[model samples]
Target: ALLKEMHAAGFEPNAATYNALLGDALQVGDFDQAWHIVDVMETTGPGIDFYTISILFKGYKGKRHSMDAASFDRTLGLIQTYSVKVDEVLVNVALEACVSLRDPHRLSATLATFKQCGWTLPKQCAMHTYATLIKAYGQTRQLDHAWKLWSEVTERKGLTPSEQLYGQMIDVLVTNNRLDDALQLFEEMKDVHGEHLDSQGFAVAYAMIIKGYAQQKECTKALQCYDQMKEHGTRLGLVVFNSLIDACSRVGDMDAAARLFR
Candidate 1:
């Protein structure tokens, strides 16, 4: 219909027009027709560009999330067969999907696919990519490899580990009962960037440390960390508040607990 309208109006349909049509097809659940449009673009002039490929990959990825495993793999196969240049955004999307799946075997397999295609984490890859992969490794209890990757990216690659990255590592460490290392990293975060740092990230790090200390029955240390938050005037979230309250209750500091509750 659109093509007929274009022809009637003598408006030459270009790549953008084809891409728009293809996107509409995907939007309406016509994957086969979308692929046909992709093929048309390949055979015609002005082949599929970066945006076109990104849209296709993004659409397939979104579709794959709700699909069964076989359908998901089929979508992945279609994406892999594309001959377009894969950018960091595309690779990041793939990594995020693998992480969301939470299957270490699938994660490793996707990584193997990356290896086969000569794709590595590019130096300019966004922090989220590194964070996602770190999280996947953490979920798999591959802490050593996770830390090695973190260190390589931060120290060697010269990427500044964002507070979220630090939070992720700390959370993973605390999960694995590596409280000592988690505390050390938490202190590093605090000492490196002293008081008055207003960020949700800092709040998260604080909560993790407080929770870990509380779990260890170090109520004094937990309260001390809580006090530090007050000193810095960093805004606290409900999660932190809950951790502190739990800490006080665990230590039978009913008075302190009530004070925090109020």
Candidate 2:
């Protein structure tokens, strides 16, 4: 409100006003206004150019949200146009913007942006970037490469693998006809990350393992896994039972399958 009065009175807003506008847009994540303010500050003066660019990045973050996403390419174009001398925060935001794009080709190009900016991808940023890449790769039928990357990341130093991380690995294994590998990693997940696996996770993971074995024509293993899940109170839902029945029929265990249904 003070800023509007100052602008109206032919008194150009001060750095504080400019700073406030940029900050408010960020704190509240008003991306549309954030970008507008960025243009205004850059037009106003370079005294606050860096600060404005930083806010523009925040604006981009606001757009990362659904129902608020703007044109990422447009934001990227403007940022690159204005970032003749961008700093670390600007670079980080730009890389994050790439993650939000969820475009495999564009995201791949972000590696170059990191190189050009001389900025290290922070762990949070790296994890998300890798996750987006994994999803893209899976959709593009590049599952093997995604698995390879997942393995490398799992072995990285000073980084504990997360549920999402292990889940990605399990996804790759199951997709690639590697049921045994998925089961082994599921156990490894329990051993290495005790108390982290919740009931939902246990249920989901066991279901996938059963599905994988069924695909492999391994009925006995699937039934065993189902029993184990039930023992843990992760109720064996109807879908899992249906899958078990299918597996039993596939491997010539109709009697076992009948007993299961009863």
Candidate 3:
């Protein structure tokens, strides 16, 4: 019905018409046709403005985190060209795209721009965002990037790295065979009195470091770290001690392993 009007009115289907049709198609999950309509408008460009581009982004925001970077660039261009006021929701939506896509390159860029625009992220949410980026990198065995961001998290994240984040880095460092650095990271996570510092910090940081070192066949370092843990008045869970025993057994130090396991 509307197609007939578009055909008769000779309006040439500008961005507004494209957006309205896209919305209707999306409402019924007619996604393939929705994309087709968007592409048609893009091909017929210069008339596509911020509101139109933003409408398309709204449609794809959750479904495709790592969409064609070009699409986001086009949308951002629309925002700039139209002098649209930026807001937290917009920045967050961009970040959400980064998280789902795990595209650190663009995510990092967006985070910087978000700060430049005077958007203050909540401490908790910022930690999660950074952690998510790091974890995604770690999953891909991209330790260099992961550690680089981990350094930023510790030095300037405006919040203590959560136990989970710290644990993730420890795992990555161990994977990269950089056991000493991992142990040092674990130490930095400690507080003045030598406690694990934050709630459950030891559970993730200390325990994971020990496990990683053991897996790396560097049981000595693991034991050394365990001793340090005791000196700091942190209670060692029996499972942690058992892990050390297992490490010793793997290296033919059965006596030491047996002694601890006992």
Q: Which candidate is the best by lDDT?
A: 1
lDDT of each: 0.74, 0.65, 0.65
Cα lDDT of candidate 3 equals 0.65
Candidate 1 TM-score over all chains jointly:
0.68
Instruction: State each candidate's clash count.
Output: 0, 0, 0
Candidate 2 per-residue C-alpha lDDT over 42-80 given as tens digits, one digit per residue, 9 for 90 to 100: 676334445555565565466455322355555555545
TM-score winner between candidates 1 and 2: 1
* Stronger candidate by lDDT (1 vs 3): 1
Q: Report model 2's TM-score to 2 decimal places.
A: 0.55
- Which stretches in model 2 have alpha-carbon errors above 4 Å? 7-19, 23-31, 47-64, 67-70, 84-97, 121-159, 168-184, 199-262
Question: Tens-digit lDDT track for model 1 on 91-121?
Answer: 6666666566667787677667666666777
Ten residues in sequence with the least summed lDDT for candidate 2:
66-75
What does each candidate score in C-alpha RMSD? 5.1, 6.5, 8.8
TM-scores of the candidates are: 0.68, 0.55, 0.46
Show the colliding residue pairs in model 2. none
